[model samples]
Target: MDQEQIPGGPEGTGRRRFLALATGTATAAGLGSVAGCASGGDGTSGATLKGKGAGKGSTPEPGPGGFDVKAENARPGNADWRVTKAGPARAIEGFADRVSVLPGESFGLHVSTTAPRFTVSAYRMGWYGGARARLVWRSEALPGVRQPEPAVESGTRMVRTRWPRTATVDTKGWPEGCYLLRLDAQGGEGQRFVPVTVRSAAAAGRTVMVNAVATWQAYNRWGGYGSYDGPSGGYASRSLSVTFDRPYDYDDGAGLFLVYEAPLIALAERLGIPLAYATTTDVARERRLLEGAAAVLSPGHDEYWSPEQRAHVTAARDAGSNIAILGANCCFRRIRLEPSELGPDRTVVCYKSSYEQDPGFKRGHPATVDFRSAPGADPESSLLGVIYDGYPVDAPYVVTNPGHWLFEGTGVKAGDGFAHLVGVEYDKVSTGFPTPRPIEILAHSPVVCEGRPSHQDTAYYTVPSGAGVFATGTMRWVEALDATGDGRSGANHGLDARAGALTTRVTENLLRAFAAGPAGKTHPAQDNVNAVYGGS
Candidate 1:
């Protein structure tokens, strides 16, 4: 079920978003429950599941035997689940009133369609033995009507919808995982996707999956406006703020998920390790998030991050929770999460180069700028162990340290290169910023960005808290995981099966080790800064 798209043009590839607002205020708003959203008791006692960490979810089931993620994914999958017919942009489409929800909670569905009837199929994304997703819940055919067109706020240029709530989904017996609620019109007229995360409240000893919700909305151009360009396609007319209140455009209305996230989710779930889920928004507003988690997985293209989330994730890292950044330019943009018409933290505000006009900045709040920029001066390298460098590149990913534990199963010698594994955007270990010490360089790929020669570096470092952090330095890492064929937008950059095998093996290695607890205690990073940089 998909609708209006940001028409393909000179800047339609979505890569332009990476370069857009490369330089970038919003204020933190109080958290509140969406009007129609309410939790379904803990699923154990039906005791109202009240008090504390509302909507974050209850404690995750004990162990592999408890929730049985392996068994849950073993259920028969729907092969005809993809949104194959995106007939017209306005044929059928909708958005969830909430980004995520705890099991048993009910959330409103706001839909707009030219078709008279449409059905909602909730598909939890996982391996499903390569079926990729399992149909969890399906709704009876619901009546539809065209919602009012969204309007951009005069001052902020934010586009928001006032669509009426069409249906209320009750997640009583649903399993927690990343979900794509497919809206399908009757008679196969059209189809579009609306993503939602059934988040884990407590991730004490499981690998926590984090969906980059804010980044998804930041790049969403549903109403002909985004962080990159507005209706006129001028950078100056771009929205300073984007809201989750509206549905996304591009890739059948799935935003960046299928491209930068779904493949990785499939691989992770394929490993069948104990898993929990949360979005970046949950990390920012939830209490004690990731404190006792085994590991945290940040997906490809996770760029916009709120300061509150940075503090929370950094605290988790310092408390012995391993962190894996599988994307370039993660936590690079400082943002403010504010309340929307439906609920709290649904609006992401990033003033970009026009931060001076952001009221939050004037009030001494965190400016919505680059994490490494002024008024903050906190380089992402301080946490990511790599600084974001150049972009728009396609080069071979050269193995610099094939002996590293993360690459243990991937048989490759030093200098063995995987063509096109480093591209679009990249990061590098640089001493010029606030970087951690004892960081090891694993892959060093030479690339030409905008006709400038530079290099991409994959790195790892360990903090004294016994937590180990590894960064992939390239956004293509996730895309390559599914390189044998399926690319959501055909954005796999020609990476072949070899590259796919290489990424999968290393990812498996990383997840298995990190899930056991603090990885620094078992496999500490070997420093090679001098060897890689030649003493600078």
Candidate 2:
């Protein structure tokens, strides 16, 4: 392979024709038109967005070995608001004091609502005896509690919601896995959820999967303010900081966990893979949690990262723990964790608009902005093998390097496009940033982003410490795990049956390999960057 001979290169007629045909067919089927190319662009072809397949509404039957395809129970209302309406309604919604806990530890709940009474139920998520989850415990109807109204700080535009503790749950015998606490108001006001992870004290020799709770809280807009939304409900009124004390306002408070994190957990448990669970805050507070783990799996839309969290995970990789980043736009935003009025590590501070607003901006620290931005200047590509490029795209995920081990048993070939698997946000390798050398470019799909033509890449790279890093370079990777195509709005990205099958196969391959000690020790990635791009 040579630079000009690459799949989407100018000299590759087959790929060009394939893309053209795929775009035309997609457009004819009522999907959106392909994005236009800018002049002097990289050698990649543009693709039209495709509609969700007609099989979107069909339920997937169990696969071989009795593997269940349904894991929607992890989310509140089982991914259907109608089901939530049919059940007991509740006005109160709350979240746990801590995003995660260990066995033998007690965690508190912070509730908010006008109802006078409510109850909590704990459901441990897994592939339990053909059912996706099992109810472990239920509380007697408890008095409903409300927190003080959120007050805006005068100077920073931060909303501090100092909620009083309502109830406490003891995890004396809770199993080590993902658990969702369902809050129901006896007054029929509706339902909501608080996600909790029971950390395994015995995480040695297991693969540790991290749930991106920090990112979820960062985007949470419960108190009329989020890191993305300002006081006036506009982007310009965005808050510089967000607190975790507030309940998520979307999807009955399940937030992004169900679509992005639960599918991977369900799939891992179904395969009976030895697994441990933790949150970004947990890793930041205690680095020892990652010790002796075979790998750390970061799944789905993990955009926000703290300095300590990055350092801990980087140290783990250097000590020979494999790293698998299963989504794009990962480690893109650099943020700092601070103790809120409630407790430690409860506030996420990121001044995305102006670095001057950051307390450490003038101290020569990594600015509270996108990692690749100035003053910080630490491109995530060095760690992720690819950097965030652009957004608002929905194109096919074309396989460029089918010979890689990650594609084993997928039956994909060069130029083969998995319908609607790449979308909304994607990443790519560029010489403009500090990328690891000798990296392999796997999926190089051309798509338009904000009117500029570019390419998205799935990359794999290995380090001398016998640690391997893999990135999917697309936000839709984990959402596609729901072969049934039932996902939260704005998260599913129109994935269908074919996309689900392809993503599941590749994910299984990645998990199995990473679970077995250091992946680079036995299956080192063969770098083809020079051969493909003619770079040094």
Candidate 3:
């Protein structure tokens, strides 16, 4: 039920049906910030970077927590940190002023509540035996106030709050990983989530995992407005810009992490892979964060992107870092980041197809349109290999090349099917787009989207620079990682252990190979496009 940025909608309207389906357990989780009573972890310490630019390399020396991914998860994890009771929205909710912080930095968590008081617990996401997170910090009870209602900017229809800082979170001893902060209201009135990423300053020699912050805020409707729809009762009145100054109204304010990204993070951590964390915002402004990184991993449902980020990632790929796009419909929309009341890159600006009216565009800036559209005219397929085809689909994924290294251990034969794995939204290898050469089509699945017959595809391609790029072509790929027979979790979308087994093995093969170094040199792709789509 993830809400996407609809292409042809109007000014402002209520949420589509999918946004209303965000009522189940979070399914998975990621990231955290600010801790009290924290004593150990690994990351650059004390060198707080507030709006710092382009300084990409190793972080400050580790403080109390020494830098060791294996040692950090070796500690006993606290399963009690998961939110057991998420009450009404007014019960308790909050937002971190910064999307990410270096270890030992301080950031404000602006919270609102109908309860008189609330407590906060910070959980660093990882693999600890069966426990997926560790309770690294907890704050003493703090007074709570229902902050002022969010204000909508008149011209841009942007939503933001003027809330005072409810608490100053200190990350003196936090580990550099993904974290989720739980807001527990007094007297059991309500509980909510606020997520933060303790990003790695330097991701050299590790696989850099990117959090899709832009896409998360693009779908946020806290003030009853977003890039997709607005309160004016139509998409035509949609906000031209959305600010991170307000709380997220989706998934109980945890944003999109639990369903879309957390499972992947958990699996990666479980593998004990050398991993670095950053949001798309971090990648956008930093020029060399990916330098010497063995690989870059973009998680599920990433759509909105800044041009600077694309340039950085392209540069990284050119430098031989393997690229793994773990979802479909990624890098579809072009967006610009501006500062908000709090700081830089806090505002996500996009006019969709209504780009001509954007103030930035009128000033001779790149228009905030689809990346493939005329205003910019740079199609994402040149980067992603698979082009986003359509949405609102549910079809079994049919393996077309089970012999590929990605499916090495799966033992599936060609024509094997995983029910409902290609869903909601999908991508396909299209010759019509600006496609890279020697791309291999791995899976081909038929679907009828909005009554239009078409096929979805999974693809992998290798460039001469020895960089290998793999795309999943399905948004449900991450969510299916945790699928069980009962289909109890909202993330699974009814996919069973069959789908889980397939994705897990393939992903394991994918990541381990990519992490070893330039994947094209180690496991170069074999082109098979002609065999899959003859004469097309």
TM-score of predicted model 3?
0.89
User: Residue by residue across 1-536, what tens digits does model 1's lDDT show?
Assistant: 12111111012343354433221011112221112222122211111111122122222344652355776666656666798899876888888888989976867777788987777777778887789977766654666677788888999999988776766666665678888989999887899999988887788888898999999888888888888788777778888888998888877878788888998888888888888899999999985978789999999989999999999899999999999999898998899998988889999999977899999889888889888889867999999999999767778899999899888878889999987788778999999898898899999889888888888999999999999999999988898888875332334677778889899899999989988889999999889999988984
Candidate 3 local lDDT, 385-475, one digit each (tens)? 9899987788999999988889998989999999889987899999899998889898999989989999999999999889999999998
lDDT of each: 0.79, 0.70, 0.80
Error of 1 at 218 (Å): 0.6
- Candidate 1 stretches with Cα past 4 Å from truth are 1-66, 485-491
What lDDT score is found at residue 431 in candidate 2? 65
Candidate 3: lDDT over CA atoms?
Answer: 0.80
lDDT of 2 by residue, 1-536 (tens): 00011010011111111111111111112321223211111212112222121112221232321212233222222222111631332367777767778854767677766777666666666654435565555555656655567787665567776666665555554456677877777766767888888776645677888989888877677777777765465665677888787788665677677777878887887766667778888988897878878889898879899888988888888888889998888998889888876579988888875668777677766679887777757888888889888766778899889999999998989999976788767898786788876688899999998789998999988888888888999888887888555433343555677788888998899888988888888888878877656775
**Top-down TM-score ranking:** 3, 1, 2
Per model, how many backbone clashes are there?
9, 8, 17
* TM-scores of all predicted structures: 0.89, 0.81, 0.89
